[model samples]
Target: MWGKSTAAVFLGMPLSVLVVGFAALLSHDQASTTLPWLLLFFLVWIAVMTCTFLFRTGLRAWLWMGGLTIAGYAALHFLKASGLVRIAA
Candidate 1:
């Protein structure tokens, strides 16, 4: 019961958002290429990451970071699949 507690789910959410947003913003630039959605996403993610930190739970933090890594991989897969990104394959 403790391992899958509401706290872990809640705590992981923010960190995931923050990390995803960071990836989005870092992936693109140029005023015209800039997207409001991306910016919003970034801010939301930062907020989430902040909240996770506030929880100060070591297990939650570790899980959050793990989820973040998975999310990053998923994003990369999407980008590659869409042909928006190339990995020299």
Candidate 2:
């Protein structure tokens, strides 16, 4: 239990940030879209934390979450490089 909680704090939290950051990068930049995306961010965070306990070991959880975080950021970078997504200056 403590291990899972620790993983949630150390690994899952960063994973959720990467997830939310990727989502925001893909979302429309209008101010009207901000609230919904913020809500989605919280939901994604909770879901990631909840899923952290599914792994049999804390190490496995860390590995999976780290992989996801890397994948999310990589996809975002790819999209930006490919001109599929753009950020305002």
Give the winner by TM-score.
2
* Model 2 alpha-carbon miss at residue 9, Å: 0.6
Candidate 2, residues 20-44, lDDT tens digits: the string is 6666666677356656766788788
TM-score of each: 0.38, 0.74
Deviation of model 2 at 4, angstroms: 2.5
| Residue-by-residue lDDT tens digits, candidate 1, 1-89 | 34434444554565555455545445545333336545566466556555555545657665766666678768766876887764321
Per-prediction tally of clashes:
3, 0
The 0-to-1 C-alpha lDDT of every candidate, in the order given, reads: 0.56, 0.77
- Where does model 1 exceed 4 Å of error? 1-34, 54-56, 82-89
Candidate closest to the true structure, highest lDDT: 2
lDDT of model 1 at position 52:
55
